[model samples]
Target: MPRERHGTPPVGSRPMMSIDGLGDLWDTLFGAQTDPPALLVLITGAVALVVVSTRLPWRIARNAITIAHEGGHALVALLTGRKLHGIRLHSDTSGLTLSAGRPTGPGMILTLLAGYVAPPLVGLAGAWLLGGNRITLLLWVAVALLLAMLVMIRNVFGVVSLLITGALVFAVSWYATPQVQAAFAYAGVWFLLLGGVRPVVELQRLRSRGRMPASDADQLAGLTPFPPLFWVGVFALVNLAALLAGALLLAGPFLTDAGLTL
Candidate 1:
């Protein structure tokens, strides 16, 4: 990817708050070439990978299960007299276990619900949080996770909640420049919400429309028109967009003054 030259944004080269300037923050000394063509290549490559993954059936199913599984672990811990430790998401069904004694029957039931409750709530919160700059994204997510953990402090998993929050912030900070990091930060926040919030909202809407409970599978059965192909298209577009954005900036384009940008 074309990287920004290592210096403050050049005088009048671009607006500090502009998208081009923000995008330029992804500039690097690690073989970064500011040539418009190279920048376009990086954007295209990044977009393709992301879109393809999103459209995969396995990926979607696995993420769905992961959502539930996280809740399960928290719920089970609560019921079993085990301290609810923070959840760890893998690429498959959740493993709801605690670091302490096993719970009785009622405890098992609570553990199950923990997984269920977390996803939707977390998602709903995320949608509202990601509407701004990188710092806003980071702070919003951190605050949300920390607050949620605090509410569940009696659970053993509370401590790890902060750790998880820290990890995300670190990931974005380490890999991204101010602008690119901000973009990923926005996506990360939305990903949490979409995984939980959008699904629940859809479920509610479905129920209201049909006057019957929607039968979302506990297993990986949810499917819509977005297939592997859909993801490919999305990534392709993102890369194109990235190139366009870069070109516009290099050619002296102006970004909207609004504080939002990818």
Candidate 2:
């Protein structure tokens, strides 16, 4: 019989598969984590509120909202059977998504309407996931969306913004502890819920001042029988409803644990 070589496995002895390793990976991706303390959840909400309310921080953080906003347009465009050309994110926290289809139709209307409503809807979804203790799944899903959005970015700033955001989310998902991931996910969802309202408010303000004549609301108005202000009101209503619903989902557990009713 031939001698076994040094550092090699003995004859007919193959490396065994690691059931423990696979179990760990599955748990990391899909397992439910312990709910974070109520105080931490409230603190994250407060932090997100500050970012949305403050001027300088909002100027920077609004980029994330812009990503979701444009992504909404892109998604709706595709769903409506339109051809998406590209998307651009500017440094001013404004973005544009280009798609080609019938110049006037329900598809076009829905695509235009999707931008302002997307963030809060996304936040509500995230809140639902967190309510189920799928914190890791939430972060991973965000990273996946960002990666998918990266393919349609049409400008330098958009690419840089997406890459940075994706990197941060991926880092947290891959390396952070469960507690940290939960906090980050909660903060992000809170931000989206709160942040979603501001843009509609701003849209109306800009429209009143005649500053943004070509805004989504204005475009929707031109396409449909409704006026610009009407569309703006629609956006406001949807976002506010989403905020309220998301709040209940996120805070209901804490309230219940405290023996309080909302």
Candidate 3:
């Protein structure tokens, strides 16, 4: 970790939006380290932990993923002309999004699709930011989104979850060392990228046994020509692609340094 030294420019100097001000801001937020080694360490640690999260029975990690999942549904609902009622987070790492809209239409279809695709989509966006070395921006964006979700959180659990997550993100972005901030950003991205894949698999399993009555995949099946299993496969493929792409973005510089291409 490195610390950046900052001082206000002399009075009557360049405007805040000038190049010097922008550079100063960037340095203040991210420090001056854009080295390959630091990035490799951050990316490697995040990848390893995300891999473990997938295999281990970690309740908290799953819950975090669930919040993102439900938040996705709520966000899409509002975006698609639906009146978002609220979000409910359950203890079993499952969630529900309630909204007011046409029962059958494109809005409903997109809202249903958003949940399964949200985590990865978020991960992909995070990956792009991390790839560009915008660690502070990543944290701020995360905090903003969490705060937005907090407003629509109806249940105690959802409120607590959003508060805790938002506070932690804000705290780190404002106070943590640059290296620690980068590490947290990487971990969040990794979790989003990997956590989205498992639920789709579980959905397919439940669909096979006729246990999932109104799962997103089933809803998608009814809305379109694709079968439930086919939609499940689509979700799986999208998540897998997201995971791979995020990984590549994080590790691409190192690979290029090693004379590798993929």
Candidate 4:
């Protein structure tokens, strides 16, 4: 017979807090737990942060959104069989995604559109995971995305930004208490959900003044019969729909309690 286990198990068998055990901790912290009020507060706070950031031009607060934007283009380009050349991030909250492909084709059109749509789509996915109390999954997913972008970073700022962003997500996922991870994940999801809409409005304003040429909206207009203004409207509509859907998903428990679920 094997010896009786002592106060602690063997090294490999011990209940260690490794990456493999992240699920266990996440479950312990948020599994099957629904705190609607806290979730709402976090989402509201995230929206406020983005609103304030919009007022402050060229702030570091906006870089994360820019990274997500450019990364979106790069990702779609690769997915559509385009060769990604590089990505560059600027301090002015602008970014460029370089890829080798037909200049005017379906691939180009999709790559152009991906930047504006990525944030809200990512936020919606995050909200879905949060609704199921999958906080660890959210953090790890963020880390994976940041890392993927990091490999495509072709500029100093891009590399630095991606590294810092990846490190934060990794730190939160690997070391932070589960409650803290959950809170951060909620804030991040809300920020992405809300941050996507303002840019579409700004793009329209720029286009009206003839300042934005060759923008994603303008490129979309060239590809489709719809005008640039119409494409902007479509982007706005998508972001708004994502926002509303994310909010409802995040608040599902509360809505169910209020007999509002359909």
Residue pairs clashing in model 2 are: none
The reply for model 1, stretches above 4 Å from the true place, is 1-72, 75-82, 85-93, 99-110, 131-169, 197-262
Inter-residue clash pairs, candidate 4: none
> Residue-wise lDDT of candidate 1 within 142-171, one digit each (tens)?
544444543433333333544555566656
Residues 1-262 of candidate 4: C-alpha lDDT, one tens digit per residue: 1110008787778575788589777665455444545555456656646563667632666787788788889888889888887888876888888888777679878888888888888889988988887777778778878887788777787788888888988898888975677677777887888787778878888988999887888877877888888888888999999989987787766676677863
Error of 3 at 242 (Å): 1.1
| lDDT of the candidates, in the order given | 0.40, 0.90, 0.78, 0.77
RMSD of 4: 10.5
TM-score of each predicted structure versus truth: 0.36, 0.91, 0.82, 0.82
Candidate 2 per-residue lDDT, tens place, 1-262, comes to 1110008789899775599988888887898888789988899999999999999999999999999999999999889988888899999999989888887889889999999999999999999998888999999999999999999998999999999999999999889887898889999999999999999999888888989988898888888999988999999999999999999889966887989866
Q: Could you tell which candidate, 2 or 4, scores higher by lDDT?
A: 2
Q: Which regions of candidate 3 deviate over 4 angstroms?
A: 1-33, 36-57, 259-262
Best by lDDT: 2
Residue 77 CA displacement from its true place in model 4, Å: 0.8
Please give the TM-score that candidate 2 achieves against the real structure: 0.91
